[model samples]
Target: MGYHVVAMPYPGRGHINPLLNLSYLLVSKDDITVTFVLTEEWLALIGPVSGAPNIRLLSIPNVVPSERTRSADFIGFLNAVFTKMEAPFDRLLDQLGLPVSCIVADTFLPWMTTVGSRRNIPVVSLWTMAPSMFSVHYYFDLLAAHGHSPDDNLPERREEIIDYLPGVSSMRVADLPYPTVGRGGSTRKHVIEAFSVITKAQAILFTSFYELQPHVLNTLRANLPVPIYAAGPSIPFLSLKVPPSKPIASGAAAYFDWLDSQPEASVLYVSLGSFLSTSMEQMQELSMGLKASSVRYLWITRSEASSLQEACGEMGLIVPWCDQLKVLCHSSVAGFLTHCGWNSTMESIYAGVPMLTFPLFVDQYHNSKLIVEDWGIGLKLKQRVGEEYVIGREEIAETVKRLMDLNGNEGRELRKRAKELQETCQRAIKLGGSTDNNLNAFVRDVVQGQCNFAN
Candidate 1:
């Protein structure tokens, strides 16, 4: 047998999707047996797929469905995972038929790392977010240490710019994903709990390409106690090797067909990821905006209108869920209207598609800032309604028109820069590249018992 690699991810679609792709890569190598632990609700949502024989899907007790309507409570979820899920996971490791070699878990799930340390099994923390975002979270302790929290209010602090995150230009405190830094209570406690785990992990696996975050990665290596591995462009790694048996469903065909029909460098691709739900008003605005722009677009939206042909009456296409990578690779996709999610950002860069960024919650707003203000390959649309940063349909329409103007000359130049980024991403993932080397070194230094640290 080979190494037994176990992966535990958070219950969200954004986190689970990337980890699953990485597991597939490990399983294909023939030297890994992957035991993927999912929340019970997540497992039920995905149903089943014929994956690698060595890869097994196990369910843990996060019994609550992610969709349950409730006030967003940060502490409630954290405490539940720590108090309940921890013991069963430890038992799962103990009962495994194969000797467990290492556990790779999301950095947000601290209890798993704690269990790994206690059992003497190596644990590698996987970060699905960008390294810049990780750096901010890692340094949050500094804010609290300086009496910045509780004493001062969040809205007051959020106006201050954060200049410390590596490779990042000066970012507003509001740009930091955890915008509630100085606010007391569950949100603050949750941030502290997550950051505490960073120092405890033997190694940290960041899902990013080195070229995309060179200075940030450098800063992380010099400052952090644990090894940091930048192993990414992981999604494209999956796109190149899908098997025949696991065919992409025909339901995704309308988007592809529309993609096929457009002139080269003429279409825009838009999606808000799986987890986000736009207001009906917002959806109608976006639909109208696409029509007003008069550019070919293939949008992946989850709606009853089943297919793109059904959804777009005359203007563009809208499919429930399309093969995003395939659509991005199509020559017709000149611009991307994105939510600036890390995974979507990487995918856009890998496809060399320039973006019109409309970032929403979490780290997305920051990611959008980097791509637009720092990297210059994308543009950020300003909010229309108020200084409060609430964007509306008018902003969406204007941004799309701006990108598609002059037959997309501006979008094309941005695409050229994006292609350069694509090359950088590819180089980092290849043999002897920064990302590949980092993954190997991280395993040896942490997962292979090369380091001894007390928790």
Candidate 2:
């Protein structure tokens, strides 16, 4: 009989996309059967999963409000995920015909660990962020011990350098994952509880390559109780041999057409993920910056920012969304202006595109730091202290010019490093590479019933 695995991702685009990619990879194995579970609302929003019949898409009723309704109230959504989703999730599992051999769930939903334990099923906690960020989360107790707990005066201490974390060097307190110093609230509590229960999982799966953060990954392997598997840069595992005839979505033709017209490595692609919304002032400033930079660009913005197109002049195109992976993979694209979400960061790395980071929230700050400092593949937009979090037009323009000016040493070096990292990312997914070996070993362990609770 085939090994039956069920995968559950947290209800966010960043979380869902990586898990879906992982499901696709797992189903490629002949003796594996995979089921991807999500809330009905989210399922409808994301549409269908296009894959072999061994991979099934299933959904439970979203007992709480949809992402559209609760966009402003993140805590409300977290509370619902913690309190409301469990019963329905349990029911879904109980009704499944195939005896579930294992469960793979996002680290955000720790309650799933309890459910899996109760059912005597091994749960592999899949962390969708960079392993460096996971190291930060795993060491929350150390943060508290070092007088950097969430209860501290965060704004005042934002500039403090955190050099004490094992395997991490010269990191600022401000760049630590947001939850480390977040204000006291239900969200903070939920995050703390989530990390605490992660140890209960039979094994931990990171959507990162071992080489991307070798020191941090090594530290985690030595200290963590469970087996740690580096199984990713998961996006590349989903790549196809032939390019799609058109972009995945209908309205992206004009944008891709514009890309087709641009010279190789000349355009900067800008996107800030799906959930973040910038203020009008920031949006206008960004528009002015792009206009002033004199470089070809393609930007994705919400309908609210539609008016800013007047400022962009003929410099670039602005669309609501497009096939990001396709755009990044294009020859015309050079650099990315990003909010430093891990998903975007990995995609950029995969495409060998350098970045200009303007991190908005959560782990983005850390991801930005990694891109700019650790990996040497990007630069950060400037932010002034005690001022409203905004990048002025001049600073944005300067940063863009510095990145795109191929004659300049900085730009050349950044692109060189980005290309090197891209080769590393590609190698990791190929047969006998680190990620391939890790993933195969993990699957074999699970199939052989070798995974067990660490404690």
**Largest lDDT belongs to which candidate?**
2
Q: Against the hidden true structure, what lDDT does model 2 obtain?
A: 0.83
- Candidate 2 pairs with clashing backbones: none
Candidate 1: TM-score?
Answer: 0.88
lDDT of 2 by residue, 117-199 (tens): 78988998999998877777678788888877544627878888788777766687777766422222535677788998988
In model 2, the runs with Cα more than 4 Å from the true position are: 150-153, 179-186, 247-251, 384-387, 451-455
Clashes of each: 1, 0
TM-score of each: 0.88, 0.95
**Decoy 2 TM-score against native:** 0.95
lDDT (10s digit) by residue, model 1, range 172-275: 65566633222124455665787776778778888888878788988888988877778786674565555423334365555555566678888888888775
Report lDDT (CA) for all predictions. Answer: 0.72, 0.83
RMSD of each: 3.6, 2.1
